[model samples]
Target: MAHRLLVCRIWTLSAKEIRCLPASSTAIASTSFSTSLQPSSSQVSFLSPSHGLPRSFTHTTRRQVSFNVQDNEDFTERVINSQLPVLIDFHAQWCGPCKILGPRLEKAVAKQKGRVAMAKVDIDDHTDLAIEYGVSAVPTVIAMRGGDVVDHFVGIKDDDELDSFVSKVIGK
Candidate 1:
């Protein structure tokens, strides 16, 4: 019972869309759901009174919280031209604080639903972007809306602080 409730909660949080289909006798015999944290795909399945699991059920994609900036063009397309507000995380692979803050920031951004998106920029790999953004240190997070900088912070922030910062960025 607890597991069912937990799965429902997670589904409510992560599901982009839910569709109901007629349940089959076989599907009604067992209840199951699948979850994954993979960057490429995440899926959850639940049975409704009228809906049964299909043999070839399609996987629903979760809202992506972490986006790795591939190059200048990718950055421009994903970050600069994004309709949603974007939080750009400029960090280095070796930075201890960046490692600590990355997950926390992602969690904060995830809580925002699709209101905001996060883009990760590796300082070492994207030297030009870092230089252009004036990122002298690691773990620099810049928030932008409509292709313009809005808010930013450097160093590690606690979960609560990150939540507040993200909310502020989205003008919540």
Candidate 2:
């Protein structure tokens, strides 16, 4: 009987057309184990938490944030000459403070949305940039306006402080 049940479960998962099965079969199908093993359907996927709209019908889009600075030339073009104010986060991978502050800063910048942009610089990777910026510490955040350093702060700041910093950088 157990072998028959196993075969039924496998068959049910393989057959995508079988929806609204009998209550007896549903007892097995409703189990968490069977749910994950079921084949994925591309025909209609849900995007919203309520599963309200089909994936194609959803109007939501994502925004880009926290870009990495590739090189000195990239920096000059993206940050220095940018029409919008840029917030540069000077961080090192091994630095604990940097790991903590990076996400917090990104969250704060995201709150301001397109009003400001964030650039992350790895001090170890781009030592020259760090040296040029006079960053002697890990997690140094600098605000740039028109290619010049307008304001800066060192160490970790809470979300509220970061929000305020972003506001000041954008002159809000």
State which candidate has the highest TM-score: 2
Clashing pairs in 1: 23-52
lDDT of 1 by residue, 120-146 (tens): 999999999999999988899999988
lDDT of 2 by residue, 1-172 (tens): 7757755554545233334445555445334223344464422222112443222346867787779999999999999999999999999999999999998998999899799999999999999999999999989999999888999999999999999999999993
Where does candidate 2 stray beyond 4 Å?
1-60
List the candidates' TM-scores in order. Answer: 0.65, 0.68
Clashing pairs in 2: none
Query: Each candidate's root-mean-square deviation in Å?
Result: 13.3, 8.7
Model 1 poorest 10 in a row by lDDT: 13-22
As for model 2, its CA RMSD to the true structure in angstroms is 8.7
Q: What lDDT score goes with residue 21 in model 1?
A: 24
Give the TM-score comparing model 2 with the true structure, all chains together.
Answer: 0.68
